[model samples]
Target: METVRPVETWLTDMDGVLVHEEDAIPGASDFIEALKASGKKFLVLTNNSIFTPRDLRARLLGSGIDVPEESIWTSALATADFLADQRPGGTAYVVGEAGMTTALHEIGYVMTERDPDYVVLGETRTYSFEAITKAIRLIEAGSRFIATNPDPSGPSPQGTLPATGSVAALISTATGRQPYYIGKPNPLMMRSALNRLEAHSETTVMIGDRMDTDIISGLEAGIRTVLVTTGSTRPDMIDTFPYRPTRVVDSVADLVELARAGSGEM
Candidate 1:
């Protein structure tokens, strides 16, 4: 096997890479410990904007993972950071949970429903038709559309549920406007994460389960990418994509050795 270069920084997806539903995938805890012991900067990235990092940390702990709150990044934070950079102290009409709202507030953004500067959409368990209607009208009235992520659906115990991208599409169809998605697949999110880590893309590695979102974004951001087949993707599906991840593994367990190697424990 060819020697893999040690990465100084790591960006990993949360859903499939770390946990599946409420259960921690095998080796997840060890991988996190390895990264921490290596003294490398790492962030757990997620497209779900329904919960805050604190909430996510609690959830991960319940599943046997011990990641710190500061080490988790979400689409909500990325969206807020993007907005703050584009228009500081701007007002927005937000349709999301406390995670999205809190992030915007911390960045000095005001939340309003009447004639706001922008209509920010994100993940919500109970998406209100009335609110989506309001978003359409707001966009028609000249508010720019911005969505936290472009994921059409999200995984659940029962099944899949409509997510931010589906809601964004409804509003777009109603108002003839497309939302600027700020999560994975958009290199802006990766750049924002890199900035947060104070890390260079050349020496960073992105580990994710989905190729379309995680792998493609890392490639575009000039970082090494690893695709784990323990989540939404299957090994049989790898050949379908035109682009490929730098490495493919059966699960996160397979990376534990590499992670230890990166930490010079081999």
Candidate 2:
């Protein structure tokens, strides 16, 4: 048996792990502060591509969690990074919000609805039918399909709303082509985050709530994964999955002790 490496950096999910709707999870702030104090490179990750990092930072700050803008990595950023690396200055027909558009623009990607090289799908509060139609047409015309994340639904104040994955499926059904999902469960997102933090997978730990997206992605990326029960997944449901996280806990609150212990403070 191989001994696990001590955690030197941390990657965590945002929605269920840190905040729920606009509220901070209990002790989330302290866990983030402790990571900063311990001098460990860390990032708060989200599959939602509707908001930019600055926007997310403001939202988290409002909830009493002071995560830096640079410390927040969105699927929008990951998609853009992937595009830039795969085809620099590529043209795409974008079907998302400011977060997705701004990231593509920063990477010098031209957004066009006509004869684009790619059709990028992302999260939006209001996904337009016309836009979906256009995306379907583009994909039929040989535009490569890409999506920010594979989340079928996202949380809302009223209830769950159909997200990028649902819309992507609609488009795929129309065009008979599936999208290359760039977010969690792809492992590409994890590698991109690790690259952004200059962290190694062997010495980094991934903390998230969802087993399908978070744990699977981390495990495939060759990092230790911890599933916190404070979010989408319940402790009872964990055993249903054949793969397992390195550890499980009630919430991010318990991670404070683990982080401290890793730093030799406990």
Candidate 3:
């Protein structure tokens, strides 16, 4: 029998695993605290490119979770990292909020509309027709197309709202170009986070609510995956997916003990 390596690192999705909308899930704070006490590497991951890590940190704090600013990883950051590696000091025509723009700017990327190197799309509550049109024209004009994530819809107090993926689809229909997505299920996001933690997949576990995104990405990145039922994916929906998580539980509350055990705190 193969001996399973003990988990040393954690990558958890932000929305379903930690918070839902503006509310933090029960025991989310305890789980984070346990991880910090464990002195293990960890990051709170989110595909929402609307907010920077600082903004996210504050929001999480508002929800009673005390994650450090550096411990949060957003899809915008991953996209910026990818772009910096692909073309150092490149220019882009951006269609995103401050999170996306700030990330690119930090990577020495200049945002412009005149013959840019890439047309970068990210999550934005105010996705304008003008900005998307510009992106379409730029892509048609030989600029590379890239998006932060492929989530078609995002949560709202009212109902589902169109997200980056939905807008990308519109652009693809108009320009015949499929934007390269760099978020969950892409594996690039996972690899980037792992690199940030300097952690190996064999000793890392990804905790997420969505099997399609979190579980798939973790599997592709060669890490253990845990599915929680507090978010998009429920227990009954587990068998619908051909892939399976290493484990499944009711919510992060249930994993607080495992988190403690992983660090020998139990």
- Top candidate on lDDT is 3
lDDT of 2 at 215: 99
Clash number for each model: 0, 0, 0
TM-score of each: 0.96, 0.97, 0.98
Which segments of candidate 3 are over 4 A away from where they belong?
A: 264-266
Number of the top candidate by TM-score? 3
What lDDT tens digits, residue by residue, belong to model 1 across residues 170-232? 888888899999999998889999999999997898999998999999999999999999998
Task: Evaluate model 3: give its TM-score.
Answer: 0.98
- Model 3 C-alpha lDDT per residue in residues 86-120, reported as the tens digit of each score: 99999999999999999999999999999999999
lDDT tens digits, residue span 1-266, model 2: 97656789899999999999999999899999998888888999999999999999999999999999999999999999999999998999999999999999999999998799999999998888898888998899999999999999888889989998899889989899999999998999999999998899989899999999999999999988889999999999999999999889999998887775655321
Report the candidate with higher TM-score, 1 versus 2.
2
Candidate 2 ranges beyond 4 A from true positions: 261-266
Global local distance difference test of model 3: 0.93
lDDT of each: 0.91, 0.92, 0.93
